[model samples]
Target: MRVTLPASGTEVDVKSLSRTNAKRLGEINSKIAVKLAAAKADGVTEEERKSAAEELKALLDEKEAMIAALYPDLDFEALPNRDVLALIAMTVDYSLNVPEAEIKNWIRSGNGEQTQAA
Candidate 1:
């Protein structure tokens, strides 16, 4: 995907473009460094890998929200949801070492529908 910068005809890949998302993404990327190290070790459990991916995906989606919020004039809706989600999932997989139960707890806490049940 491509978007023209404000007041400039030059076009750039949507990933390269930056607003608030840029900084948050940098943090995510930094976090991934730790994940990658863990993944390289031979004994990583399948659950760990899965949790890392999911957290990465969530962060990337968050980055999209940040970009959209910061650049309302830019037509971010043009970006494909699958692409964005996939990137986020991959990021979560590659970058974080969250325990699966912790993530599940977080998910449960945020589930509005389930909140009523409790």
Candidate 2:
């Protein structure tokens, strides 16, 4: 799979995400889930929730990010600002061979009907 960074104009050759990276992604998502639950329980303001979300996203850029590992030349710090969205999308689509437009439609419609088997 390949991902292009819009800000830096760099193309990243991603050979399907590693199991370790998948695990890390899952862990981060779990943390977000917990935070969201807590925010709901505490009746946190939307602005506060948004701040927490921004901080969680910053975690993706901290240290040796999984996306950085996919690019041979760039480290986490070298990644362009606002380009992390591309990396996240590429990671989710890795090995699936799903077209970008289809993915976008799925996201828009929130319909998760599975493809029929042969």
Best by lDDT: 2
Which residue pairs overlap in candidate 1's backbone?
Answer: 32-95, 52-92, 52-93, 53-92, 53-93, 56-91, 56-92, 57-88, 57-89, 57-92
Question: Residue-wise lDDT of candidate 1 within 1-118, one digit each (tens)?
Answer: 3323332332433333343444566786677777777766788899988887777678656666754554355455665554444334323432354443443343332322322235
Model 2 clash pairs?
A: none
Query: Which window of ten consecutive residues has the lowest lDDT sum in model 1?
Result: 108-117
For model 2, how big is the CA root-mean-square deviation?
7.5
Candidate 2 colliding pairs, count: 0
Model 2 C-alpha lDDT per residue in residues 16-94, reported as the tens digit of each score: 6667766777677687777767667677888888887786666655423666666667654566656566556655666
RMSD per model, one decimal = 16.4, 7.5
TM-score for each predicted model, relative to the true structure: 0.42, 0.54
